[model samples]
Target: MSQDERPALEDLLGAKHRWYHVVDLAPGVTTPGWIDLRPHVGGPQLPASLQGQRALDVGTFDGFWAFELERRGAEVIGIDVDQIPPPDTPQSRWAEVQAELDGAVPGTGFELLRRWFGSSAERRSVNVYELTPEAVGGPVDLVFIGAMLLHLRDPVRALEQARAVLRPGGRLVLFEPIDRKLSKRSEPLARLMIGSTIWTWWYANRACLTDWVKAAGFTDVEDLGTRDVVDSTGNKQRHLTLHARA
Candidate 1:
């Protein structure tokens, strides 16, 4: 690689930002993210090939999954509410925490990495609730949300909006943290609210997630099972991946 890429890599390295996706931007360079999800994609959680398909990636922190989908021949668009200057809303506080950790504003990392990779995938500064077919320009073939739903105050509404943004028979692949207590008890549609202390709104059990997908007008819903991820603090969390059809 050229010396020019070194500056960009240095900026990423120098920053204190907390990363969720561990992305290999180049042969010898990878982002300093806590969660490395590259191995799990295209196995069961994601499609093996997204050729000729249009995809939307919700809550794309650093364009990891968005770029991955694009690499698979999909025209990809990534949407998130992490503004450059930051907002004053509740979500902005979360962004602030990330900024303090990153030593830069939230959402700025995505722009930097996109330019670094020379990727053609599109990105927008939009909220999850604002996602609709009209807002996204048109319906897409795939909608992906990785480890994002737990942060939303209205996950059901978010899922409904995601469903609206998909073409008929289009797929929605979601990976989210499940409520472990409810999962252990085997309750149907049980949800745990962890509150603002951890910046989490609700933790839906597997049954809760499946029922929400069905209620959102999805024709078929498949539980891809659980995935264990370690956060930046070395905390283990169980996440469930759900595949639903619109």
Candidate 2:
């Protein structure tokens, strides 16, 4: 691993795998991720340190949050499915979407970055709805889910599953897209956009998201506010981060 023998990031970028999170593998060798989350590593959304804790990262695409948890001294387990789940569209459209996603090789970027970082975090091929205490080897001290609810057909059930594997009094961190204008209202409201896309389902306000967390049995919920994150396509999105106790 000498300077002269180091792998070129350009050469690595030529692979077929797509990166979703910007990660620094080596000096000046960062992956060109769709979303750059490096700035939010130590932000209020995540703890500065997770020493002596066990953490679970749901929908850990590309292992960004999982590796970050490991970096903060937590034993992390990242879970994702081998294939992308179809959107809640019509049955006729399901086949089309499934056919397109069939060619997608999930966890490739995650494995690549894991090797680069020499990460001890484990990646499990498990769907979010299938999460349980036994599935993850007992309760974890922290659970982190980011930008995944909008894509799910049953977000509340997914949150309940996340709560199932979290230890009592453990921490739960949720970060997801929020409708800025809709979030201004006092009442919880979520806009349904079922047929708008093949993956996206809801455009919920912050209050609606909070209600979902509460319904999942989490307590002491705290709104850490919103942040604008830019994607690789240069599209900026507003995301709300919430912290709760399981």
Q: TM-scores of all models?
A: 0.84, 0.90
Q: Which runs in model 1 stand beyond 4 Å of their true positions?
A: 1-8, 15-17, 42-44, 83-103, 189-191, 194-198
lDDT per residue for candidate 2 within 145-176, as digits (tens), equals 98889878788999999999999999999888
- Residues 117-162 of candidate 1: C-alpha lDDT, one tens digit per residue: 7777778887888888877779999999877777776777888899
lDDT of each: 0.76, 0.83
Clashes of each: 3, 0
- Best model per TM-score: 2
Shift of residue 199 alpha carbon in model 1, Å: 1.6
> In model 2, what is the error at residue 233, expressed in angstroms?
2.0
The parts of candidate 2 lying over 4 Å away from their true place are 1-11, 84-90, 99-102
